[model samples]
Target chain A: MAESEYILEVKNLCQHFTSGRGRKKLTVKAVDDVTFSVRRAETFGLVGESGCGKTTTGRTVIRLYNPTSGQMLFDGRDIAGRMNRKLREYLTSNIAMIFQDPIESLNPKMTIEEIVGEGLKVRGNRNKEDIRRQVVQMLNKVGLVEEHATRYPHEFSGGQRQRIGIARAIITNPKMVIADEPVSALDVSVQAQVINLLNDLKEEMGLTILFIAHNLSVVKYFSDRIGVMYYGHLVEVAKGDDLYQKPLHPYTRALLSAIPEPNPLTERTRVRIDYVPERDHDYSLEHPSMVEVEPEHFVYCSPSELERYREIIQNA
Target chain B: MIYDRNNLPEELLNLPASDFEALYQEDIKDEKFQTKPVGFFKDAAIRLTKSKVSIIAFIIIGIIIILAVVVPPLSPYGFNDQNISAKYLPPKMPIVEKLGIMDGTRVLKNRKVSGLSDTDRYPEGSIIEYFNVVTAKGQEMCDVRVDAYMLAGMPDGEYHWFGTDYLGRDLLTRLFKGARISLLIAFFSVLTNVFIGVVYGAISGYYGGKVDIILTHFAEVLDGMPYIVVTILFMILFGSGMVSIILALTITGWIGTSRLIRAQFYRFKGREYVLAARTLGVPDRTLIFRHILPNCVGPLITRAMIAIPGAIFSESFLAYLGLGIKPPNPSIGVLLSDGQSVLLQYPYQTVFPAILISVLMIAFNLFSNGLRDALDPTKRGEE
Candidate 1:
C-alpha cells in the first residue's frame, strides 16, 4: 500500500468495555464506531461534552486501549489487531501521549531528568550522559533550565508541570502525540502560556497531534481541522473556520453556542441551542451515516437533515 | 476555560483580555525556586526532628540499643553465670548505701532473737536493726533488717546493680543480652516479612481479578490460622532458636504487610503517573517496583517501623509461652518468665526487666507514630 498523507486513520473504531459475566454482564461502548483521520503534521482537535469518547478515541488511536473492532492505520501500517511486543514497540515509539492532569501525569518520586529521560532509557539508551544531555536540551526547548531537570514534579506549578509533560512526550521524537486535555486543569493565563508553548513545539518538531479536549474555544484556536463528537459518535468534521461559520450537526451547533463571546453586546444576543437528538433527527424510517455536506466538511445526518444542512450552509 | 487572543471567552467578563495578553505573548521561562529543594526523605526527616516526643523516644531507643550492645560483655556477671550460693542476691551500690535505696538490704522476719546472735546462721555484723519483736511461748521472735551482701558472705566492694536471679544470673546483664536477641529477631523477621509482603502484595494488587481474589482469599485463610499452632509447628520442624523463632514470627506476620502493600498498589497502580509510565512502554516489572511502589514508600516505612515492635512483642509472647529461644539463650520474654516465678520474693528481678521492656515498647510505639506523622504528605510543613 502506498503511503497516505494522513499519518493516522481510524475506521469504525469501537472500544467497548465489559465487566462481570453471565447474568449480570454489562458492556459500555465508550467509543462506538468512531472514525476520523489525522494528517501528517496537523493538529486534529476533538471537542465534545464530558464522556463523549473524545479521550477514548485518542487513547484508542495511540493503542492505549485496544479497539473492540476497527481498522487503525498508522503510517499505512495496520495497528488495530492483537497486541504483541513488536506492535507495542512500534506504537509507543511512534506515538506518545500527554495526560490531562499535570500533577497526576508526572511521577512524584522521579526527578525531571528521570521522567523526561524515561522514554530514551526504556528504548535501550543506556548512556547516562547522553540521556542527561538530551533531557537538558529538551528542557531548554520547553523554556526550562538544566537545573529544573533535578527538581521533582511537585516543585513546579501546573503550567510548568504540563510543559514538562509535553517535553517528556515529544523528547522521544514521536511522530504523533495524543494530548488528552493538556490544559483543562490550568488557569486561563496559564492555559494560554501552555497553548503557545505547544504551538511553538508543534511547528518546530512537525508533530501530528490528536488534541482531545472539552473546551471548544481552545480546540478551535489550536486545531487546523476539528471533529465534534456527541455521545459515542463523531457528529461532524470540518475546518476550524468552517466548524465556526457553519456547524452542520445539531450537537456541534449546541457545543458552539455554549462558547461565551468576548463582546458583551453580542453575548446578550447569543442564542443557546439545546440538542435533543430525539427532537432533531428522525432515523426510524431513514438510515444516516457520515456524509460529505461540502468539500472538506462532513456531517452525520439522514437524507432530510442533510438537505436542510446543505441549504443552511448555502444560505450562510 | 480557553483564553487566547482570539478565544478569550467570558473568563474576562470583569477583567479585560489585555490582562492575559502579556502572558500569552511572553515565552514560558520558569523562575528558579528561591528556597532549597527538599526531597521526600529530607522533608520527612525535618518534620521528624521537630517532634520532641519522637526525638526523646529516639534517644531512649538509641540508649537502649547502646546498652544492649555494651552492657553484656563488660558486666561482672555473664548472662548464664551461676553463683549457686549467691542466688537471689539483693541489688547493691557503694555510694547509694548512704541513701539506703538498692543498698542490698533484706528484712528478715520471724527470726528468733537467739538465732540473730548466732554467728554461724547470721554472719557477724550482718544484722542492722530489729524493727519488730514478738514474745510468744517463752520464745522471742524478732524481725531484723540485714545487709544482704554481708548475709550472703559477699566481700566488701562487691555489688549487684540489678541483683541476681534464681540461677544467680545477673539481672542487668541478662536483660540487656535478651534485648539484643529480641531486637535482632525483630529486625530479621521484619525484613523477611516486608520483602515477602511487598512482592506478594505487588502481584496480587497490581493484577486484579481472579488472581487477586485467589491470592487475597488464600491470605485470609492463612490469617485465620492460630499463630500459636504455627509456632508450634515451626518448633517441631526447625526447633526453637533465633531461626525458628524468626520463622515463627514471619510465617503469618507478613500477611499484614502484604495486605498493606496490596491496598497501596490498588491505590497507586491506577494513578495517572503509572498510566503515563505504561504509555511510555515501561515494562510491567518497572511499573510495579519503580512507579507504583515508590509512591507508597512513606506508608511502607511506617508500617515496617510499627511491625518492628509487633515482632518484638510476638517473640516475647512466645518466650513467655515457653517456646522462646532455647535455654541459656536469653530473650526479653525468657527473662520475664524466669523473673515472674520469683516475683514476690525478689520483685527486683521482675522489676528491672519489666521496666526495660516497657520502655522499649513505649519508645518503639512513639517512634513509629512520629514517623507516620512525619512521612504523611498531608501533614507536610505543619507542626
Candidate 2:
C-alpha cells in the first residue's frame, strides 16, 4: 500500500485487562497483537463474535482505553500511551465513536439538538446560531426533522435515536468514525436502513470508517477490506470479496458459511463451525508472528506454517 | 412498556392541556432530557410530592411547630418562678383543698422542719410535703397538707391547672417552653449540618481519586468516634447551653450528609452527560452544581427531614444527663430530670412532658420515613 493512502495504521495492538475476585489475578487479553490499517476514505470491517475483543480494539484505537502495548498512527502521527489534555481533546473532536446502545449512549435528559451538536460543543464551537444551524442541517441530512432536535432521547424511536447518535459522530466532521456495531441493536429492517445511511454518510462526508460487527453480509457491503478476529486475536485480513470467495482462516470460513444464502433455488446447506471456547491456554504469552500470505492478505500463523502458506499462496 | 400516544395513561400524561404538545416537543427534543434536568428543585419537588407519608408528616410537623411557637407566650405563669406553698399541686385540684391546707396554718408554720424530718417521705430535705393536717376548727380538722414545692406563695388563682413541680413551678408552662427550646435546637443543628455536608461532599465527590480518599478517611474517622463522647467533650469546653448542644450535634452531624453527597457525586460524575458537558467545555462549577448536585437533592432533603428529629432526640438525651439547656430554660429531658421525685406524687408533671416528647418524636420519625420514600428518585414514577 502507498504510504499517503493510509489514514490509520494499528500495529501489534494488545490490550490486557485483569479480572479476578481477590488476591488471585487473571489476565484476559481483550485485544491481542491485532494489526490493520484504514486508507483515506476507505472502510475497514472488523468482524468477530462477542467477547472476541473487537469492541475493545476499536475503543483502544480511539484511546478510550490505553492499550497494554501497541502503536497507533493516525494521519501518520503516533498517538499511543498517556495523552496530554489538549491532545486528548484534539483526538475526541478528530475521531469519534458511535456506540452500540443508542439508549444508553445518549443522555436521558438532553434534547436531540444538544445530543447531535455535542461534538461541536465539546470542540468549543459555542456560536449558538451557528451550532443551531449546523445541528438542524445535520439532523435533516440524517432524515430527522428540525423539530425532532428539540425532543428528548426517550421521545424518539430506537432508529431515530441511532440517527441522533450518528449525527453526533458526524457533527465534529471527524476524518474517521469508529462505528462499534452501530446497528446491531436495531431490528433487521431498521438495521438495513442504518447501514445504508452509514454508507451514504461515508461517501458524502468522505469519512474513513472502522465498522465493527458480527454480520458478514453487512460488513461485505460496507467495508472494502475485512479482518476476522477470534479469542482476542486478529486471525485473518483480506479484501472483502476475496475473503468471502476464498476464506483462508478456519474462523473466517466458519463465519462466512453461517450467512444464509438469499437465493432459494441455490439449495445451500448451512455449514456449522464449532467455535472454540477460548481458554487461558488458547493464548500463550508468546505472540503469534504474522505473515503476508498473499498480495494484500495477512494471517497470524505458527512460525513453521508461515513459509508454508507463503509458498502455497505464491504457487496459487 | 412503550406508551403509544393514544394509549398513554391519564396520570402519566397529566400535563396541563396547554403544555401537552409544547412539553412533548421539549421533552422529545431538548438535550436536558437526555442530559438530565439541570437543577434539583424540580425533581426534588416531584419526589417530595410522591411521598404521601412525608406530606402528612410535614403537616403534622407544621402543626407542632405552630403550637410550640404560639402556645407558650400566651401562658400567664413564668416558666422558672416557684410557689413553694403550691408544691405538688395536681392539675385542676379544687380551691377547697388548697384553702384547707392554708386553713390549718400549723403545716405552714412547721413547713421547714416538719417537712424535712421524715426519712421515707423526704429523701434529701422536704422542699415540699404531701400529708393530711388538722385545721383550727374543732368540729372536724380537715385541712390537707398539700405537697406543693415552691420558692414563694402560689399565684392568686383558684388552683394549679397541671400540678406544680418540686419547685412549685407550673408544669404546663415549663413543658411548652421546653418544646420551643428543643425544636429550635433541632432545626438549627440540622440546617448547619446539611450545609457543611453538601459542601464537603460535593468537593470530595467532584475531585475523586486521591482527594476522595482523603475526605473518605476523614469521614470514616469521624464516623468511628462515639457521638456521646463528642457531646461530653463539647459540653466540658463550652459548658451546658443550647449553643453547646447545637455545636456538638452539628460538628459530627454533617459527616453523614457529606458521605451521602460524596457517594452520589461519585455515581454521577462519570455519567455520559457529565463527560459530555466536560467535552463541551462547560465550567466545572456548573457541572458540579447544575449537573450533579440536583441528582442528590432527593436523598439530601429526605435525610435532612429525618435528621431533625435525631437532633432533637440528641439534645433531649444531653439534657437528661444535665449537659443540655441549663436552669430557667425547660427541655423535656430537664423536666424529666427535675420531675423524678414529684413523678411519684404528681405523676402528671413527668408523664405529660414525657408523653409529649414521645408523640412529637414519633410524629417526626414517621414524617421523616415518609419524606425519604417520597424523595427516592427511582420510585418517583409519577409527577
Using TM-score, give the best candidate's number: 1
Q: How close to the true structure is residue A87 of candidate 1, measured as C-alpha lDDT?
A: 91
All models: lDDT? Answer: 0.89, 0.75
Write one digit per residue (lDDT tens) for candidate 2, span B194-277. Answer: 999999999999998788889889888988889888779888999888888889888789999998999999898877556545
lDDT of prediction 2:
0.75
Candidate 1: lDDT of A30?
A: 91
Candidate 2, fnat value? 0.10
Candidate 1, position A126, lDDT: 99
* TM-score versus the correct structure, for each prediction: 0.95, 0.72
The parts of candidate 2 lying over 4 Å away from their true place are: A1-4, A19-23, A109-153, A260-268, A275-287, A302-316, B1-52, B67-218, B238-244, B258-297, B325-342, B345-356, B375-383
Model-by-model DockQ, in order: 0.51, 0.12
lDDT of 1 by residue, B1-383 (tens): 22234434666555865676542465667777777877889989999999999999999999999999999999988889989778899887778878989999999888899888889878988988985788989999989999888888888887888898887778888899999999999999999999999999999999988899999999999999987887898898999889989988989989999999999999988887887887889999999988889988888998998888888888889988899999998999998888898888889888887898889989999999999999897887565
Q: Which residue segments of model 1 deviate by more than 4 Å? A: B1-26
lDDT of 2 at B229: 86
lDDT of 2 at B153: 40
